[model samples]
Target chain A: MTSQSAAVLKKKSDRKKMGMKARENVYQGILWIFLIVLALTMILPFLYVVILSFTDSTAYQAGKLILWPEKWSTEAYQLILSGDGFMNALKSTLFITVIGTPLSVIINAGLAYMLSKPIPGKGFFNKYVMFTMLFSAGMVPNFMNIKQLGLIDNYFAMILPSLCGAWTIMVMRSFFQSLPVDLEEAAKIDGCGPLKIFARIVIPLSKPMLATMTLFAFVSYWNMYFNCVMYITSTAKQTLQVYVQKVVLSSTVSDVVDLSMDLATTVPQEVMRMAAVVVVVLPILIIYPFLQKYFQSGMMVGAVKG
Target chain B: MAKKKVKYKATNKTLRQQIYEFRWIYFLGIPGLIILLLMNYMPMRNLIMAFQDYNPHLGILKSPWVGLEHFQTLFQDDKFYNMLKNTLIISGLSLLTFPAPVILALIMNEVRNAKFKKFIQTSVYLPHFLSWAIVASLTFFLLSTEQGFVNKVAEMMGNEPTAYLFSSKWIYVIIVVQSLWKSVGWGSIVYLAAIAGIDQSLYEAAKMDGANRFQCMWKITLPSIMPTVMVMLILRMGTIISVDFEQVFLMNNAMVKQQLEVFEVYIYNNSIASGSTQYSYTTAIGIFKSVINTGLVLLTNWITNRKGYEGVM
Candidate 1:
């Protein structure tokens, strides 16, 4: 009688274990569905924009959401590229990004290197940089200062005002500090001066960090909006982001299209806006996958050290 | 002992010589120092404009000081109070959304499939790199009344289209939602790192004790990252007055400007866009914002420090 009761109890426990397994499976399935929905939310908007850029204007105006256009056209792309509004903005953006990024990296690297070493007055310099991080002069005064310097309507307004970033300097300084001190000591024994060691030894080993900083500076300069709005009054000198803002947000899209009437291809304003977005975002998207690996490490290092 | 003292004196002499030798290193830093002085410190000095009747021609040094005039005007102005209210509401909503990314990271951490995890991570992080202009355009395209995707979906569901962007009723919701969409994925990264730092043995032990997955997560993971969450929250509190200026500027229109006008927009309008030289008044508002931000940060730091978490000093 005791053996038979024990077998029945064992069967009951087995059923309970099965019930828990089923519940766990359901929970896991629900989580998967939620994550997939979230992933779609992130990806679909970008994909939709791309699709709309290529969709026929009439079809888009007909109120159909185009995930994949039945008929794709390159008219919007042609319109954007042919127009002086976008092309000029593109040129200005490229010029600033090319010139400003290297200039910023060099300045930041120099300051960061100085802060990394056991130099006299290092504490004072560190405090100076940190103070800037903590406080900022308001927009009016900064604008007034820039105007006094005669940088209004000039490319220097874009490049010079943002040449050195305290955060980037600190990141680079931490990176420098992390390197083995034995190498620098060895270089010192070989009679290499501070500048020589920095140029020849320290820099060579810091290519990854340099790339990360350069990419950061490039992106910041490429996406400069407010400064251009505040400083650059000329149509020819404005960056892509500001121009995109004008065309997309303001009532200037019709004006831009009218000014570009010489172009044979005519795309609707909506399509043209999406095309502009694609153009502005394409460069970053292309380079992102390659630089993404480096960026993750760089970000971790910066966050941990800072 | 006498010999050691003589050697220490010789080393002190070399330390001074080392300072002289590193002059070139300091030379490399000079340009940065000058730029910082011009760009950062100069404007800090110009904060005095908040106390003066600033004139462009008269310049900062020559401007006559009017103590408490701007502050008194700021306190008296209804528009200033409205802007402060709007700023607080929008930022308060943002503060409420701070834990969203933490929750997302926790959810993502539970997923066992590697491929699915990678896809979610890669897709979600894509938005962070996009400029606010692009985001604004996308938001408009997706939320606009006439031909927006959301309206289209609503129409399909037999509902009338809603003018979301133009309606003041929806502005706060739009701002907070857009901010979350843009940052939630990127913000999860640090929390994920913190979670990864947790010991696997704890999980194993919990499981051995017949604890369920949810129980293990609650009893272990969340507590382990509380300090990181606290630090991030404090830092975010420090910038509560400052909204994303570009996003606000892009989305703002005559229809919703009353609701969307925050401190940054107010400053821009009075000074740059308005073509008015109300520099002193705007500077006063700016100073007010900075003081509040600093106070909030210090207050949070003190509170967190008392709780024995590392504060972001």
Candidate 2:
């Protein structure tokens, strides 16, 4: 009787273990499917943009939203790049990004580095900087100030107001503080002044951080639109975002349509709009690999506890 | 005793010499300070334009202050409540989505495959770096009546195409979904970091006690990241009033203009539309928005503290 009971008990425990393994497999299956679907949702939109831009009218009509292009063509790209609209916007964006990024990095790094030191009035100055992050001067007032400063219709208007954001300064300061105290002391004993220490020791040690900041600042400047719209009134000075937006949006074409009408009208407008978007953002994709590598590390650095 | 005396003398000398030695650092900081003064602090005093009939010709110095005049205008305007409603709905819907990142992070943590996890992260984060213009344009292609993929799909299916953009029904959904698409992966970064910081030994103990993987995730991992989740939720309350001006402005068209008008856009429209802005009135609206946002943040922070979570402030 005891042997029979033990056999039944053993069978019950075996079945329970099997059930647990089965449930685990089910959970794993669902989790994998969910993640893959989420990733596709992110990726497919971009792929669709690229494919639609390259796909000719015949392929697109056949609903060729496949992973690879069929009836692939460069007509849309040629049409977009051929236009004066794209070129002018490209120039304006280049000017904004190229000039704005280095200036932002240098000024922010300078202020942040100094503020990181044990200087007189450090607390007051740090708080003064932090206050700007919390309280802003409002849109109308800021516009009025820009007008008063005679920056209307000027490119500097786009660059100057955004130069020293309080968040960047704070993050940069924390990075500076995290550096070894011994490195700075050693530099001092070697008879290096503040400028020398900054230019030589600090800049070299934090090359990766600086590179990340530069790329981030570059992306932000490249993507700048609100200031561009507010400050730049002329069509000639309009940045890529505003320009691309005008072409892509509006079911009925705006007058800029004439500027972009170099291509045959037979080409689908969707292709043209998609091409315009892809062309404008192509730089981002090219640098995407580098951005992916550094951005995560840079974000982790910024996450250091205050 | 002698060493202590030497240290005291060294301090007295170092105080004056340190300031003198670091003059370049002080000098280096001047340009940033000037820019800060010019850009941030300089415009702040103009906030008083809320009270006055601000005239550009006479400027802030000469505009006569009519106390509470603009405030009265703001309260009485029909557009005010509409803008308020849009703000609440957009922000409220977004608040409903705040847990999305935490959920994503938790699920991601369960994945033992590092390569697959990285691929998922890199793909989803692609949208975050793109400008609002690009995203809006994407929306135009996918949802716009003329060239949208949705309309095309509908037409092929022998159904009438929906004008998603021209209707108010899809406005909140469009805005919030786009925001989530753009930010959900980016937002998960914080929570993923929080999860990484959780003590691994707790999971081991749970496993020893015969807990299943799912149970360990819920009972150990979720509880460990609660403080971060609470702090983030509290901080998110502060942004309820300040909807993305860029998003709303880019998305605005003639059909749904009334439905989409938020405070910042309204201020922008009032300034640039007729070419003669009621600066004081807009400034009053700005101040009102800021005050409410500040209040919301403080209230949420206080509540979080009372609940014994970490304080955001």
Candidate 3:
């Protein structure tokens, strides 16, 4: 009787373990399914934009929406690229990104280095700086200030106003503070003056922060539609975002159809708009992955420690 | 005694050595100070425009002092109330749901497969890079009445599709969701980094004690990252009044303006809109907004600190 009871207990325990393992397997399956669906939802809209970019205008107007192009055509690209607006916007965006980013990195880095040091009255200076960041003069006052500076309608209106971003300086300062003090001390011991130490040792070591700040600056200046809309009344200086805005906000589908004489206009304004979206953002999406390898490390440096 | 002598020698360096020792420090400070003065501090004096009846022809100080007349005008305007209401609502929603990124990071941390995890992160973050103009356009494509994706899906499921943008009731939802879509991924980065920094040995110890993955996360991972979440939350509360002006301005139209007009837009439109450049009035509105924002930051910081979390203070 004792042997029989022991066998039954052993069997019961084995069955329970099997059941738990099976439940665990089911749970894992459910989790995977959820993640996959979430990822698909995230990617599908962007994919649809790309698909719409290649769809023919006539079918697009007819409301033939599909995950794939119904009839293929690059006429939208042709129209967008040939237009004077597109070329001018592209030039303006490129100019801003190329010029503005480096300037921000240098200025922010230099400021961060100085602020990172523990010196006399550093607290006062730091408070003065962070004050502008936390409490702004708001939009109108800043606009009036720009107007008073006689910066309107000039490229400097865009570049100069945003040159010294306080957030970037703060981020860089935090990053600089986190660096080991030994590096600076060792450089000092090597008969390195503060300038030489800063230029040769500090800047080289802070490359990741520099890269991250550069990316931040580039993205910001590229996406600057509000500033352009406010200060740039000139059509010649409109950026890509402004050009895309004009296209999207242009007269409705019927208005476009009425204005154009061409039969079955090869590209629908809707499709053209999607194509424009693809064109405008494609550079960053393409460039970011390459930059990501660098960006990941840079973000790690700022983020992980904090 | 020897160490004291060395310290004295260092302190008593010649004038040339003293200048050379501190020269790079000054070098770093000067250029940065100049740029800061130009870009930040200089424009700050224009806050004087708030006090005067700022007239372009008369110049800033040359204009007569209006004292609190502009502020009185601002408080009297009914639209001012609406702007303040809208600003508070939008910011409140953001603050309430700000922990979403932390939640998302926790979920991402659980995924075992590195490749799939990366794919999820990249897709989630892609929207952040899109400009507000682009996002607004995309929203129009997906949510518009005639040919939008959501409407089409609704039709297939046998429901009548409503125009999401035109309805005043739906405008706030649109703003909040768009904001979430754009920021959720980027926002997760800080928490994810915090999670990654958790000591591996803690998790191994949990496993040894027969703790499951869920238990391990609840006990170990969450607490480890709580400090990071608290810091982010404090920073968020400090700017709870300031909404992102670009997205709201770009997405709004006549039908939704009443519901969607935020403080930033209220200030920006007064100055930038054609035939509506009321300089003194806008400046006063700006000053009012700044004072309120500053007060809120300090108050929130004090409250959080008293409650025992490490806030911005």
Interface RMSD score of each model: 2.5, 2.9, 2.9
TM-score of the first chain alone, every candidate = 0.87, 0.86, 0.85
Give per-residue CA lDDT, model 3, range B1-313, as digits (tens). 5654465477887545654666678678776677777667777788888888877788886988979888888889999999989988988877767877888888888887888888888877778788999899888888888678888778777788898989988888888988888887778877787787899999999989989889988999999988777767776877777888898899878998898898778777777774435877887888888898888778866867776765222
- How are the candidates ranked when ordered by DockQ, highest leading? 1, 2, 3
Q: Candidate 1 on B132-207: residue-level lDDT in tens?
A: 8888888988998866889988888889999999999998899888888998888888788778889999999999
- The collision pairs in model 1 are none
Separate clash counts for every candidate: 0, 0, 2
The prediction achieving the highest DockQ against the true structure is: 1
Shift in Å, residue B72, candidate 1: 1.4
Tens digit of per-residue lDDT, candidate 2, span A1-306: 999999999999999989987987888778889999999988777778888788876666533223456689998777777777778888888998999999999999999998999775677889889878777878887887888899998888999998888888888887898999898899899998889989999989878777777887888889989998888899888999998898886453324544555445666777888888898888988877887776456444353222
- By summed lDDT, the worst window of 10 consecutive residues in model 3 chain B runs over B304-313
Clashing pairs in 2: none
Write down the lDDT that model 1 would get.
0.82
Q: How well is each residue in B217-294 modelled by candidate 2, as lDDT tens digits? A: 899889888888877887787778878889999999888898899998888888755475677888899989878876
Single out the weakest 10-residue window by summed lDDT for candidate 2 chain B: B1-10
lDDT of 1 by residue, A124-169 (tens): 8998987777777878878877887888899988888789878888
Global CA lDDT of candidate 2, please?
A: 0.82
Give Cα distance to truth, residue A144, candidate 2, Å. 1.1
lDDT of each: 0.82, 0.82, 0.77
Evaluated at residue A6, the lDDT of candidate 3 is 95
Off by over 4 Å in 1: A1-25, A62-65, A250-254, A257-266, A295-298, A301-306, B1-10, B14-16, B156-158, B299-308, B311-313
Q: Give the candidate order by descending lDDT.
A: 1, 2, 3
